[model samples]
Target: MPDRNSALRGQRIHGQFGNISKEPGVTFREIKDFSYLEITLWDWARDSLRSKLAELLGIGDLPDTGDSQRLKEGRLLHLADGSLAYLGAAAPADILEVAITPEEGCVVPLGHARCLLRLEGPKAVALLRRGIREDLRDTAFAVGQVMTTDIGGIGVLLLRPDTAKFDLLVPRSHAIEVWRWLTRRAAPFGYEVL
Candidate 1:
């Protein structure tokens, strides 16, 4: 079997601000520990809000139901209630606040937590399943399904934003170990550690 690191020999890295790294053809951005903010919208205004969010983030409008596309360049804005919204992003320093109204529910700010691990490659799916419990079969966990499950005995937020790729969320402290595990598991299949 090829060495895990060798497989990821040349790939561009794409990740958040802090964890950015230079890989051949891989990009690793550190988007862990983002502040969570909740916003409430008025009735029948969710679509408008979604539109505004997409525009602000440079992505397509969100669908009426199901999950939103993973913000490739920005943070995820999740609206939990009608007349309410939730925003979470990785900020450098002070937390950002957006004012809404009492009748519009609430916009609560959550503290820093969670680590993000993105694996991109043809063999990514096969490698990820080695440590995760959720069924990764195409028919079962289709792309865009966000699931909270355990991976290698660790809690993880698994998102299959697209085929041949995955975004994993875990506690920040275990990021390295998880990466190592993923690298090691992917070896047999020519897994690369980008």
Candidate 2:
């Protein structure tokens, strides 16, 4: 791990999560607001299992399987592969309880294993083009949509839960590298620590 203290000298940056929604221009910061939980169902589980998980999490109905690419804000997000992730408002209950019954599925907290960065601004979509090749137009990747793709060769879960805002879930090991890539890409757009 690089020395965050030494690496951030003279820069308007903070350790772990950069300035949280403080600076002007595009805001880049590790997301610390919501609780992320990964729920994986068993192979024998039916499609209703997805909704059951949602009800458990209190996010409401799951998007239809055909619309797997769409993600709803403060709702249950169904991944392309049938898995589900919760991007709800409140923190989840004990992981052990959620995962106690293996027949249903398991709830795994991603805070420690993964770090999510939120970038929001008018130029947010443009910045994403630097490393992503997906069609990000509002028509295709509309708000409340999530996609698992590679950014700068790093696997990331890109979520457009809000207008002009993108949440990137990157592995902790690659957080620094991805952050550097994002900052470099946003330089011309006048990015800030926040």
Candidate 3:
């Protein structure tokens, strides 16, 4: 039998956000505690696949206006040809896959393939404006809106689920560079890693 005290399988595959201060200001951190899954539906399978996923995940009808929906505080990320969902820390891809099949869509595990970072607080928008050229005014990019744009020259999926917050998703390879760029730009205003 496996040692009960030993680290569980897949534990090390998860990312880490070390030593973030709680001091306040623009608090940012890599979200290392959630499960990420991407559901890519084949062209002809889109409608049926979405219905099945909606039923299984208990996510009521998907959003039609924006590319994301705040479901129970988390989110269901819609893409041009697929969708991504964020689950609780204890939720595993296997559990998500149980309700899915190859005929409908493909379930991609993004836990190690991508990194999600969350920025929130008073200066969050300003901090992001330093890098992205898009108009980020509250009226322009309201909560529950998601757009794919370049930040610090890196292509990223930006989601605004709250007025004072933003979530950025980038490839794992570019996460560190993006984090560095964010902190450097945020330095003008007081910031704390959370």
Candidate 4:
């Protein structure tokens, strides 16, 4: 197992609302309590891995390769089918552990640096609009668009993985400040962290 102390670099604080802060600099405010099995293939064997992952996940046809291709949420899909396989969210954790191991050039619990914030309520978009410079308009940024931008003067990787939901990934050191700022902005919109 990885070092528990290293895994949790920040402190968790629970607010009056459902918001449960996992760390002072990081929080796991469940946007969608999703469980996903991710399989990353070495660069050399991406093609073979894609085919294998498709077969394993039972997705007869994978999305075409290009900027236009995207996976649907809640569906067994491949994130980067040619290089990375994602079995969708809400998968059994135990099964995920079994499918991946040290061998097969697979890395379980892919070390992706990420932080999620659950933005709900009617005015969610308005709140985000105040902080983010990017045009949050639907016409400019549709759902599932993985965007790397800045929010509240801090660099952030934003993703609208699903409608009415937004995920923000900031540097680990800035997680706490960003979370607090986000919550304050959401006040007008009636935001709930979890």
lDDT of 2 by residue, 1-194 (tens): 11122222343384323233544457776655555667677767746675565566555566653132232335456774556676544434343235436676676766556776888988789989889989999998888778888988999888886779998887878777787888877777677665
As for TM-score, the candidate ahead, 2 or 3, is 3
Question: How far off is residue 139 in model 3, in Å?
Answer: 2.2
Q: Pick the lDDT winner.
A: 3
lDDT per residue as tens, model 1, 32-72: 43454435566755555556655765667653332435554
Estimate, for each residue in 1-194, the C-alpha lDDT of model 3 and write its tens digit: 11122112232223323333544457776676655677667778878877876776677876654467655435677766565555334353556666667886678766666677889988789889888998899888888888789987889888887889888877777777787787777666767764
lDDT tens readout by residue for model 4, 1-194: 22222212343344433332432222236332443344566667656655765565456555442112233434332344433433234343344456544554564543234344555444566767888888888777777555557777888756665655666645556666777677665544343332
- Measure candidate 1: CA RMSD: 9.7
Instruction: Please give the ranking of all candidate structures by TM-score, highest first, separated by commas.
Output: 3, 2, 4, 1
Model 3: CA > 4 A from native: 1-24, 83-93
TM, every model: 0.55, 0.76, 0.77, 0.56
The TM-score obtained by model 1 is 0.55
Cα lDDT of model 3 overall?
0.69
> Cα deviation of 67 in candidate 4 (Å)?
8.2
Count residue pairs with overlapping backbones in model 4. 3
